[model samples]
Target: MTADRAAAPAVTAGRAPAGEDFGVYLVTDTELAERHGHGVLGVARAAVAAGVRIVQVRDKTASARDLLALTAAVAEAVGDRALVVVDDRLDVVLAARHAGHRVAGVHLGQSDVPAGVARAVLGPDAHVGLTANTTRHLVEVAAMPSGTVDLLGVGVVHPTSTKPDHPPALGVAGFARIAATTPVPCVGIGGVELADVGPLRDAGAAGIAVVSGICAAPDPGAAAAAFVAAWDGAGR
Candidate 1:
């Protein structure tokens, strides 16, 4: 292990997970950010300033080098304002950590690397997350050794062009059904908006993850603040 990984805390079962509040998770979409005249890093900085507690740098199309560069930039931009996670890129996470960036961890899709393996590679303290849209998925994650995973990015809560291939939109009701069954914290994603925050929270979601709601907003910071207000108002 590198010095940074060696120095990282060992997060075992029974310990407090890193992303407990999860309140206002922001998943970046470069296209959406660019549409609003902000690069991913710029938008992330703005959102973090407005209470976005978690920022996931997700660029499926970028080259590995570019993604690493982007992740490092985001790590710098958010600083300690938010936990910086790279979506579906374990190598990038390791590389970023090796380079001395404060990338907290990674968010993996169900099809990506297994959480157990990710935890092993990232060491115990890395805040690993996984996607779970079905009851079976939830059960599988629940069965994992504790501390192997930190959070669940549960959804396609609504239809979203950002992930056209995502399984059928879960909608609020479907989302609630899945969220209710999970032991780990769930952040409702995919087409989520400010109005859905209270309802999703009421439905047992620990947080709300958004792309366009903030990334494409005319004012990213204000949009993020709205999400924060809605989440807090729900008493989460």
Candidate 2:
């Protein structure tokens, strides 16, 4: 049940069509999964079954080989059910793709390879997302050649322990301010939860990205379902 990468529709700045809801994005946390006695792939599969539309595999500590193996496993598990992306590791994404895994793209941070180089390597069809913590970052993204990137992962909406290096919490108001100015779809990450979905949507976020909210939960399936329910109820 691998996804047809060539046939997947593009996600522009505007809202996605119904059923292609990118409204609930899940970022995997290996540490969180370990704490809950679950493997990352298992949690991701359960989450996708419960309606998560996008899943980003982000493990800062795993070696390239381990990350590639994990990415491939996740691709097999949820490739048909959701968009499978790698976080901060374009090399892993490339390796996975070369290995015939159904990886959709990579989510890069400001310190990662520049978006232009990433786009050139990934080609036009691969989904490319970048993190933006300030208005300047958004402005830079907006100024990039059109189609250079697909979406913006705007963050630290609340203080999150998952990434100790995260910038200051943006809060909803700050998130709103940044989202309003971006021309691309934005997903609010860092400390987000089911309760924040509606307000995040109202603040112009195209989706909500969570780590512990689902991965650390006792029931990842139900947790992911709750997020989908909240997004659907938000009418975004």
Candidate 3:
């Protein structure tokens, strides 16, 4: 991580609903289990057991048909245990809704549909999040009058395999600068790990989005627990 990236307060790392201090950011990795050859449902179940409150299904490569099927299955696995979200593709979001899937919302990146468009399609109940890499971008999106979005993702705090083309890591300080300017809850993305939770929460992030940190672990449930513990300990 760059010097600026390291200087930001860890946002998602400190608090839990129970008022415990876990010192780790909330885990949000739905695609990581696929890397280890675990089925989507299995991975999601493991994540919920580990205290993950949210899951984002981000399979860009999956065909539309396959994506919907996978979404349905993962949604079933999460089943009230976690808030399941679909990444990008509003079509999948629609399909998930139609299938009686318990999807909580959609996460949109820069190239995906605009937040207003997504809100129109998903209706009033779904949660929407936007990705902002710079202060300008963050301000532009956060200041929009639409009021369609529920949250923002503010960084690749460090290099991440999940988004290879993402710009260089924003590190901690850059994240704090961007996050400090936004009123919406922010989640730090990219290269997040247990150790980074404390600083991330301090930076004002509502949570941390992770991929390999939990997915790549030998025991995903344990990994998930560790992440939650870290975030809770940080006083988020």
TM-score, per-candidate, Cα-based:
0.91, 0.91, 0.85
lDDT tens per residue, model 3, 171-207:
9988888878877777888998777888988988777
The CA lDDT of each predicted structure is: 0.82, 0.84, 0.70
Backbone-clash count (model 3): 35
Q: Give per-model CA RMSD.
A: 5.7, 4.4, 7.2
| lDDT, candidate 1, at 172 | 90
Which has the higher TM-score value, candidate number 1 or candidate number 3? 1
Query: Candidate 1: minimum summed lDDT over ten consecutive residues — where?
Result: 1-10
For residues 170-236, write the lDDT of model 2, one tens digit per residue. Answer: 9999999998887777889999977788899888887889999999999999999898888878872
- In model 2, what lDDT does residue 100 have? 86
Candidate 1 error regions (>4 Å): 1-19
For model 3, what is the C-alpha lDDT against the true structure?
A: 0.70
Candidate 2 residues lying further than 4 Å off, grouped into runs, are: 1-21
Worst 10 residues of 3 by lDDT: 13-22
Ranking by TM-score: 2, 1, 3
* Model 1: per-residue Cα lDDT over 134-177, one tens digit each: 87898899889987888888889999998989899999999889
